[model samples]
Target: MLEPGLYEQTISRELKDELESEKDELVSELRKIDDAEAPKILAEYVAEVAESALARISESGKDSLENQIQLTNKMIGALDSPSDLVGDSHQLLYLVPKVMHQIRGKSERDTLRPETPMSQSSLFTGSRHEPSMGSELKKEIASADRIDMLVSFIKWPGLRIILPELREFSERGGKLRVITTSYIGATDVKAIDELSELPNAEVKVSYDTRGTRLHAKAYVFYRKTGFTTAYVGSSNLSNPAITSGLEWNVKVAQRELPDTMAKIRATFESYWESNDFEPYDKSQHDRFVEAVKRERGDKTPSDLVYFF
Candidate 1:
């Protein structure tokens, strides 16, 4: 059980008294739970009550609740130490709801209402994610210890020119894997061939001989303790595309790279496995295309393309 020191003075006193008063009632409830076949129901009840409390705190404020969040956290910590619901599932069911409530409550109180002027706190917490780009990333990558990348395509001209850089990685001993797909041969052909020839590099290429268009462009670069991934609206693997037109790219910090890499790897494997079959395999991709064309009007991207 958590000691009084774990809580603030006022919260600690109130919690101790509440626990003392509820001791017999809780013991009785625990005995009933032990005999009940449906333990999950009891867990749900705890979770729901905690969630309700959290919502109240969030709608109100810490000051309004008289520091109920602190009291709840300490109580949850105490329940965590030695209890019948010590397992992660049960404990989470009991505590997470309350924790969320406190977080929401604190946030609402500390934050300006929709009626008030937006400031630094509002800006910081507003979006769950945002683009990170600029000289800061360039400087960090420049000094990083290692760099690894996977890309649908590279926009630099004469990507064969980068073969030396690819060779240098092999010469010095490093790892890189890349896969490319595109609507035309001229766009990704040279880069695919160049990287494939490197000593230790892995490269995959997808060609839609049936005039199927390939359009997604994504890149991953991992360096030292950090990295960056860019998902772009345009495929600029060729010199003409990058030098001649306006292209947009959203760069995200690679702290979450592992998950993204897994997704990319899975997609590559799926494409590779199906590449040998006839283009008319009627796979999930085909179903999705049909659904899109049917559900959306003729203006949707899928409606304009013919797969079969």
Candidate 2:
């Protein structure tokens, strides 16, 4: 019998009064609780209100209430456990970048081309545009877990150029194995002595200048990150050869040629274990000197022989 507008206003006022009463009851209950317990109760109520609001919005097809509720809960949970949230965030920060780097590296490797200037298997001609062997060697030594050098002879000038890099590598627990000989009396005794004095360096010398005939010149850098590379060509560990000389060395990557890398490693291990090349002994310096002098066909007295 009442007017339609009057009925609607009366019902709306009743609903508003009921909501106010409920809010007052909630406030009274919160006041009765301890300060520590009040926050938890209030938070639960807040989550419930948020869920209800989202549910109403979902009815209008704005968003999903369930998803919104879950998101809200997660946000609140993160606030509740701040330290755990921070720890999880930090873990994600580290893992995301690492995963991205791994993915990028794999992609690059899959599309890698050989013989390009930037390619891992590129031919190093010691050109002005190409990287110098000395610089490349320093770069390899800086990152290598282990380093192996096989040269017919090692000149003092060349060894000195990379001596600082070798020292730093050795100090960081990197193992260094060097194989050389007095084949042409070009290997300097001082260079060998300096190498032998490094913290984790082992030098092997073949005194059989005529029989050993060790003419190979290769440098292998072993990395724990699986980026191992070997330079095998005509470049010996001499200043001119590594720096300004027209040296031609082929860089071989383990990732690109596994079999070749395996052979290189096997051959090095065999030579390292052979009796022809003996471990350098500081006590036998004089014997080494005599062998070098003998190879050079010099009759100068051992005391007067100067190492260049």
Cα miss at 170, model 2 (Å)? 0.4
Residues 176-213 of candidate 1 have per-residue lDDT tens digits of: 55555433223333345455566666654444434544
* Model 1 per-residue lDDT at 96: 30
lDDT of 1 at 272: 45
**Model 1 local distance difference test score:** 0.42
Q: Model 2 residue 263 lDDT?
A: 96
Stretches of candidate 1 exceeding 4 Å from the true structure: 1-162, 188-190, 223-232, 240-244, 256-262, 272-308
Using all chains and alpha carbons, the TM-scores for the candidates as numbered come to 0.37, 0.60
The clash number for model 1 is 3
Instruction: Name the lDDT of candidate 2.
Output: 0.75
Model 2, 145-209: lDDT tens digits are 89999998788889998899899999989999999998767788998999999999999999987
Error of 2 at 87 (Å): 24
